[model samples]
Target: MKLGKEYQQLTPEDFTINPEQPEDFQQAIAQLVTQSTSWHGVVQCCGHDFTGEETSVSETGYGSTLLLVQALVKAELSPLPRLWLVTQGAQPLDSHPVMSGVVKSSLGMVKTISSEHPGLRCVAIDLDPQQTVEEQARMLMAEIWSESREDEVAFRQGIRYVAQLIDSHWTQSTLTVQQYQFLQQIKTASISERQNILRDYLQSEIVQVLGMNHEQVDLQKPLNDMGVDSLMALELRSRIKTHLEVELKISKFVEGVSISDLATEVNEQLEQIETNQENNLDNEEQINSAEGNNIDWLEGEL
Candidate 1:
């Protein structure tokens, strides 16, 4: 029997949350942890004048894996800096003498970096060679300042809302029509549901729009590689709005580093957009009502 068919027979209870086997249900989570390391190397290399580094570590996915596991744990548990080395996967490593010393050394390194250094920040832009550093910085500042005080408050609230969504599995819960549409617009599937609506749209609409090939792209790659240049980033913004019929901020690119990360970021922005729109409508109605009341009072005085 095939592994796919056999794996389908497993139950959620078979993979309960525990310290012993954290990577049980969320393999994607583990994969993200690994990919984050590769992404870190790539980003670091691209940022500096270096050809990528070479190390004989079997765990090429170490950097991303460490960053994500730490982030998720911090987000879920303590907000402090710490690290964990998981010991279960398709290729398991025994807790033997050869690996034990290395694992301890790695943990020590994680603790040092997590405590001393601020985490890396990933950013995306839609600019060409024509834009100077000063020009780009000015543009970013203007965009940041465009948000009124009220919008800024709503934006922070939107981040909390997104944290909640991730806390809950991406289930189709109760949502407004627009919220539902936004979810549908960026929906992507794992290996199982690759042919489903969300994944299909991601491949054709998003992947094609960004000029990425199916073969060259894997689910784990950084989303920026999908021709996510400045123009394509704006194109993604426009397409998302057209498909979902909701406006979202471009700053979400700075927050989400990978394709999965981008999905989370977009969802958060969509929630913020919805909330802001609702608040604006309510304020407009209140203003109109107050104006009518003032006109009625003047008429009575006359």
Candidate 2:
């Protein structure tokens, strides 16, 4: 059935139950699915109630969401039964380790479900819990129906933030004028100099990604060990390819790859390009000289 007026005013208390045992909670979820014909959406809130023993909170929170998703998948008659996962308190980026881990894992689940089910709409909303439940519900409903193409939204201290995923890497065009000039200057530089420049650029990027200073990064260490997740890796690869004007595969950082090694590869590519340019110039000059000789012989015959 449609979650119309009754569901609009729903609160966290509606789903609260004193479970005699954990299995009882699962039974309750099963019953929820069995009774409901269809749902407009599902809203999950993680806030003060989610803060307890780390193990308990994490297990229960994640498990409950999992069950809800499973139930929704089975019962949702319409493709667009929106799922809104709400988190309270500090944003995930600035949260404590335990809280942050839980949020990240939850978001990961949302991403996976969204990827698998194109018709299903999943959004994660983070907001401060100091506001009234009505306010929170209003904001969530607005987000559920928002036409914005963002999957993540946050409301903090009277401010609203939306995350729109765009492919920054693939859209890059030719280098800027400054970049072209710099490339021209470096084209004739020694391989050692070229490698040093590339290495320094990579080191700077790694430090920024890790949210640290350059001195804190070890260029020789593997990037994965430094907490460079898949998303960060894509960003790093994008930055390098865009600025350095070199082609690089994302898998280069898959394993045993270091900044120094990447620098070496960039240096080799530069040298190859320079060599090809020189060969082309020499062939053009020779062709011009041959044409001139033929013209001189024709003049003498005339």
Candidate 3:
């Protein structure tokens, strides 16, 4: 509705291609583009259509999009119209890892195509699915009008972020004596004990973060489905780092992760930390190692 005024809105009947039928879908797309020899842009908004996890490229948008790319690239038009692939929460940014969606392939197609063909203008824009429709519309409009040469971009909270590749280094934080010992004990903990410990901690965090009763929280249900958005996710992640002394991506909460599932994930991270701490043990990294019994309450909680 935000773009209804400026752009000519096409109804579903006007241009909905069935990806299951490759040849027909390809033909439909080719004819659609041939409607005008020159154009401002042809935007393909994806991630709205539902496809199963087992769906192949021929049964998904990927195959249809491939055909479109071939047509656009081979067209004898003077100035190629910009091909815009707009998706929702399909990009993994530096901090907020967007929800991976089926549109990922289409985004990559346009980016690589733009590089191979200088005359073609390809813009891949990822919008935060958590944002309101009004905000997403504004982001799309801004990117459409801006003269940025960046082929790939993502918008979060009205801020535009472009992807870049640079030399990076792995920097580890100095763990305190208590944190190191806790990790070591956690690694030695039995599978059931580990689950009980971390699951209890995660339950407490969820109850506190969402202000829900402990009895009301279901360990098997996904946290995001219980209304943990990006902001709540940030708080939950911070709480984990503070108490557990482990850093986790914000995406961990939103990607259908239940308290039970996160407990297993936390246990795995603790194992990795146990190894790293042992290898990097130094004077500064080590303090008087606390006894494993210090976290005995962890097992007792269950």
The stretch of ten residues in a row with the least summed lDDT in candidate 3 is 283-292
Pairs with backbone N, CA or C atoms under 3 Å apart (clashes), candidate 1: 33-64, 33-65, 34-65, 36-64, 37-63, 37-64, 126-230
- For lDDT, candidate 1 versus 3, the one ahead is 3
Score each candidate by Cα lDDT: 0.37, 0.61, 0.64
Flag the better candidate by TM-score, 1 or 3: 3
In terms of lDDT, model 3 sits at 0.64
TM-score order of candidates, best first?
3, 2, 1
Question: Per-residue alpha-carbon lDDT of model 3 for 65-178, expressed as tens digits?
Answer: 565666665554545567777877676553654334454575667767765654556777777777889768766765675444577777654445665634322122233323
| Candidate 2 per-residue C-alpha lDDT over 1-302 given as tens digits, one digit per residue, 9 for 90 to 100 | 11111222134223443322344344445566566646666676643455544565334455556655665555544433667777765344333333556556666767986775534567777665666887776666555643434567666445466554563111211454344335554664677787788788789888888798877777888777777777888888887777666777777775768888878877888778667766864665466457656877999999
Clashing pairs for predicted structure model 3, backbone only:
none
Comparison by TM-score, 1 against 2, better one: 2
Query: Candidate 2: where are CA atoms >4 Å away?
Result: 1-38, 47-53, 57-60, 90-98, 164-302
Candidate 1: C-alpha lDDT: 0.37
RMSD of model 2 against the true structure: 25.0
Choose the strongest candidate by TM-score.
3
